[model samples]
Target: MNIPMFTLLVGIPLVSSPVVYLFGRLTTRAQVLTRQGWIVRLLALLAVVATWFPFINLWLEFQARGRRMFFNIESIWLQLDGISFLLAAMVLTLGTLAILFSGRYMAGDFGEEKYYAMLLAMIGLMIGLGCANDLFNLWVWFEAMAVSSYLLVAFYREQPGSLEAGMKYVVQSAVGSALALLGIALVLAQTGTLDMDQIRLMVGTMDLNKAGLLAAGALFFIGFGVKVAMVPLHTWLPDAHSQAPSGISAMLSGVVIEAGLVAMLRALSTLTGFALSWGWLLLAFGALNMLYGNLLALQQSQVKRMLAFSSLSHIGYILMGLGIALVSGQPAGAQGAAFHLFTHMLMKGLAFLAVGAVMYALFHEQGIHRPLVAHDLNGISTRYPWVALSLSIALLALGGLPPLAGFMSKWQIFVAGFQSGNGWLMGFVVFAAVNSVISLAYYAPLVNRMYRRVTATSVKKGSASISWTMQLPLLLMALAVVVIGLFPSLMNWLTEPAGAALMSIFR
Candidate 1:
């Protein structure tokens, strides 16, 4: 309930990143858990755990107060508005799980110390982005995340391709940041306030300068669009996702993009009183992303690249939900978007972790490129059954199959779309459903390669000793996927109230 609790969640990781970099310089360890790596990992993990305590406390506080926002921490960061207590909780939860899953994924890497540090730093930035109620502060954190992410993507600096991907990401992100800053300037020029709550209040009273508002809206959309990888601006995503470390890939696809979306939603909520054109623009972009992403993914041969494109497609669905909420001025679509955001995070995180396991095993033999024929997976279901099973569940959920978290969230989005009675938007939702089936065409091959295909020569099994630190998160996420799928009400309870709070920003 105190600012220290929220600050600790963010500050610990912000401080740990540089510390890990320093450790890397002083230590001669090969594996992350060896030499100074263990201590760094412990501290990073502890920082995550410490952050979780406040989230728990906040949850309790929310229950008692019957208020969605709590722990309002304010200071002179960029503007007067402080962070959202609930969004902070969500960021901490996802960031902790991401780091935990990285344990095994990053094992025996050369730059483990640096890897953990960047990761922790990413966690800190995400918390700041989520918590910041000031648009200027949000933009700062947004750019910070962009820089950290570019570094992480190119962490394998020795690899030319990785460096290239990182450069591409940086260029695109810089353009986006510039646009966002311009939008912020425009908003400030018009409203004389940078605080999101204050902006929302002034938006209605301000003169309706159509040209300026539209330009400002376009600027904000382009900025967030680049991060969200909306169609026509998503060129950097596949390259970055394909080249980045598996753990970084997970975070990128799972949470980082969502942070951008959250910021966009916050900005949109603030500007709702101005016009409905912004909502229309978001809907158009969402439809384009869904169509283009699926079409591109259908052609990808690389596993990671396919996942990257799939991520783009799924983000379309979230945008669709947001668009619907804005167009109808109803909370259902926003709630659906929020729920889907969480479900997508869990499902994609699990999927990437599973892919990491496969890649790790393959690295022992050839590399990620070798075709996984039927015989290659012989007895994999028997030996590493847990990994195999988890991967299967993740893939299925990602395909939007029922009784999984993915399906539950998507169903909510679809219901909201249909309820809006907007014919064009409903058509977009239908197209998204079709894309879901298209996704299955790509995902099914992995399952077929693992279970149904028969190999002549058996491949070697992965080491039986998976670290508890890593396995626990995967197992929990896998279980969560199924649990939320079966019981959608749990997310409904969380997201519905969050959506209500967002809507209140307008009222």
Candidate 2:
């Protein structure tokens, strides 16, 4: 039987998840555990790859038709528009590389079968959340993704830090979900419908309860703010990102938080006049996030923990672009935000995966799995030249250095702010630029340590070869950062439409 594009997009991974577990069960009885794990990993990778077809087809259709498409059943709507397509594509691409990296990274870990299963489930749910057009259904997808991710975060149940981090993540996420649900309930009570389009029309035409709508908007902001790691609501991120497996770390910092941003944007679109009030609120929060994230990262000695904090600062940049877009209705701001979202997934994903490769090498060489301190990377360039190079590129790009994707992405946002001709917004743009320079204080040290000389007192640099599986993803992403940096126009096809889609709400 033929399945709808939306169903197929969500179904491929969800359906493959269980089948992978059953394969694990069968392989256990028929083969050795090592072989069984490889089989499971292979199957999981194929399942993620299978998702590409539907996404590509849908994207082609959108490009050719140049319009949004909807799939409706009663009040439940799953729509394919520029933003949804961009987000879905991000989820699949990053999810695929993370899963592939997992093949070697998670090979001997306990519960290999469950690891792949939960990862796939989270990917599918994130896609659903992006495409969902009904408020209640969006919440359902959000919760489902949270459930799957919580398990993955605590996959190393034997480790105290892992369990502690997972508990923090689940508790904070549950409360955020509750707030979002409450906001949805208020929206439903106000309009008697959860359909976003219907609510938009009702809110625009009807004499609604302004007080009630404002309350819902506030709730939505705080609820989604937790996941976006916006300052003050961002306490849960450092532990969750640092404690989880490196592959999961890439997903959390790279795509997952961005998904939260998209969800918040979609929710806000349903509430008329929210942009006028919330737009400046985003700018204030953006500035706070930048300062908070940068200062905290400077204090971190652990590599992953530092990277986790840097994510907050990058999120702040995206928020600034989005804020400008909302307040001034300039397509440049929205476009910059969209472009940065794409660039960040590459830059950050490469950083984590490259660092994870070093961790993996050390584990195999020294039998240690503890958190890697930044100093531990000293003289690593001599032992692992390729990985050292990859990590340096990632760090430099993330620091917004010239001739890297990060530089171009930040440039776009700065240009957007200046083009608005608002003196205050332009000042924020200067603040963001200075923060970008200050960020290198921490980023540069990590790169410096990698190439520093190994002394008699320094940690041992063992000869542990990084497998092709891990190195492949790192190299590919590093190339992408350079290529995109050189050719910024290459991504306009995706970012332009997304910006247009976002502006549609304002019109």
Candidate 3:
């Protein structure tokens, strides 16, 4: 797993799709494959594990070399550099845990093979998207990930809302893709090159007019904002997240949405070289996202849907940091954004996985259709203390409670906000601080509900036990959250380099 062979990070997952498909074919026969789904799960786990080593090595090289080019295509259409390397690491880590959690979370289900393959495909596609060095390369991986995710969202087609969720996700993504392609076309028309490096050169030297620049920026913003689920572009996220399997939900919220933000950042970082004036616009949108997303999340009764809206607000926090970076010319803002993205993944992943554990336990014992209402958590702590504790930790972290990972990340964003010392940015900083308080309003109640005592009539008892496999991922992530919270320097070590790399594109 040397830096030289780091392209294997993407390659391993690509090769895994078919190998998983082959083994999935065997799951139908008892003699050939265990009825317990050990084959497909193991192959998927191995593929996930395989994706991580290269990332760890690439990360080390990146820290030591500070922008080492690990691997690339024939002409470097997709290249592994500091920015892509860390994103690839996040995708693989969450992807591995999602698959492992699914092994137990989705056991004994029909069409398990196809389900597993789609998960692997998503992991591979997201990894490729992270490392893509050009806009067109990103578009390609995006279309692929959209296709797989559409299927993954509809994985439990027999269930009531799965098909609708898949359809909505596809329609929204297709619209975004159309707008994204237009943005790419605008760039290609002006620059005559899709390479980010060359785009930088062209933007600096060419006479690309203001109108053309603005149009391209708007199209890219609207397009990628759909996936980021910002306010006004956010309708699709609630249903898709609330309906999708929890393991898949983790990917969608944890890394898949961030992929959109990263792609937009890549394009903007290059376009900003042309003196693009998107700073004020970014601040406006970021503030709106924080205010709107948190307000709506406060009203949700469904557990997953609440998490979904909160995700919209979390993205807002990251956007605010990024906006501050672009507007203020301070790299620490970018560092704060990157730090939030990284830590947010762990928190959301744990939340989704733990919630999924509850869903899985209830799905087996309930006689009929089971919806994921907050009421389902009534006195859950009395029954499943570990699940309740893990879920509570994640909720607290995301709510920006002190002595948790989310607090440190949010603190960085706040620092970045005011560092500019501009009147408008300072106003938004205070506004975001208030919005953070609004966010805690919802998370606190849910944690309290989970720990409260329940009357027998109010709480439905689950007959099946949640296995160690399901609980382990949640506990591990919770522990990681605590460790990082205690040692906040981990944020600086990982994200400062990434932030520096992002800023270097313009400098």
Candidate 4:
């Protein structure tokens, strides 16, 4: 028997979560500073690293055999294709880096073990979602990811607003999940199938109730839209992202929402008439998200809150590409969306980790954890040169500046939009372009502040230095952002096939 690569890919971390918790329970806070705590930290990190073997093997197998893989064991169906492979790679790469950074950044924090556990579980569930070939399995993974993330958001239970944010997140997510489940029920009732490929075939061939399909589409849009942070449904994001620990914030802003969009795309793919039913709506919402999110981000002085809003704007960029794909039936839009998803993970993940490093340094200096304001970063570059530099790179890339990962990704999306050749969609693309420039209004100023001189009152009296564990992820991600920008073709092998896989459902 093969090693069950897909199963192990998700199982490694999922199983490790409890083991880490058990080990964590054995160590006291003081013991955590000692060898005992290091044991727990290593356990968490090694579990994440261990998954790499299976992932690499799966990728190699995928390449050698063909473009796809499928598994059926114990009645669970798993599909591995370009889309799942791309998403799983993103989840594993970012999850590993975030957990590694946590080894240092989360050190000595209470329940440090639980933090690692939840993070791993969330990553595992996300990967499961990417690979799920059944509707119910996808929802299970989605809900499980949400539950684990909720706990993470409220991790600092004693913090003033952490619990409040968690409450809001859970409530909204529960509602969204309910709506999504209802959508699934409708589909299952009409077609008598939970398998995505079968559902696609049935919908295409059978004359199902048109009204039920329309209702399913609406339900799914609203359900997944909340996670995608589409304007009207995005109320929970800023609070949740701002309240979560910095590393978790990076995961949430970076890959979690991207996973939600994938779930939405998969569900929508099973139904017909997406171009007529949802394309225009997605375009309108995409425009709103870009403008509204950018405008809000511009007004934020708090660092994490600003980044939270920025994620929404970037989500808008991605949705516009996907929307164009649906409307025009072109693969370029989907390809661009897929490419941008990969780059956004790198750019935003770097940004949050870099910001987290600063906060970690600040905590050591001040003996307290507090929200970081942009103004506090003034003159920070003089002391924490590497962190300051990495943050700047992240900010510039996010603003879609040239020769950076963000630039290339955004360029692909814009080109996809233009290629639609529909005057109206072309106009929407132009609007997205203007919003991209508008985003820099905030991004540029933040980068500028990092280099400016600070007043004596604003400066910390003690030297603030970041640990190498945290610094390594920052540099690695920053390098990726720069390298990918300059050489976009390097990722084409993955992005092209992933795009084709996604568009295949349409055909």
Write down the worst ten-residue block by lDDT for model 4.
455-464
lDDT of each: 0.75, 0.89, 0.82, 0.88
Model 2 residue runs over 4 Å out of place are 29-34, 72-75, 455-461
Cα deviation of 254, candidate 4, in Å: 0.7
- Tens digits of per-residue lDDT for model 1 on 34-84? 365556566667777776775666566666767545344454442111225
The sequence of per-residue lDDT tens digits that candidate 3 reaches over residues 211-236 is 78678878888888788887888888
| Residue-level lDDT tens digits of model 2 in 1-507 | 867777788889999999988787666654645355678999999999999998888888888899999876445679888788778878888899999998999886767888899999999999888888889888888888889989988988999999999999999988988998899999999899998889999999999999999999888999988999899999999999999999999999999999999888899889977786777988998999999999999999999999999999999999998888888878899899999999999999999999899888886346676998887788888878889998999999999998999999999999999999999889999999999999999999888888875721234555668888988889899999999999999999889999899888655
**Quick one: how many clashes does candidate 1 have?**
3
Steric clash count of candidate 3: 0
- Candidate 2 residue 88 Cα shift, in angstroms, is 1.2
lDDT for 35 in candidate 4 is 48
Backbone atom clashes (below 3 Å) for every candidate: 3, 0, 0, 0
Clashing pairs in 1: 83-131, 375-454, 375-455
Across residues 354-401, which tens digit of lDDT does each residue of candidate 4 receive?
Answer: 988888887635677688898878888888888989999999999999
Off by more than 4 A, model 3: 1-4, 29-31, 34-36, 273-276, 365-368, 455-460
How much is the lDDT of residue 324 in candidate 4?
86
Report the Cα lDDT for candidate 2: 0.89
Error of 1 at 3 (Å): 6.5
| TM-score winner between candidates 2 and 3 | 2
Candidate that scores best on lDDT = 2
The lDDT-based order of candidates, best leading, equals 2, 4, 3, 1
lDDT of 3: 0.82
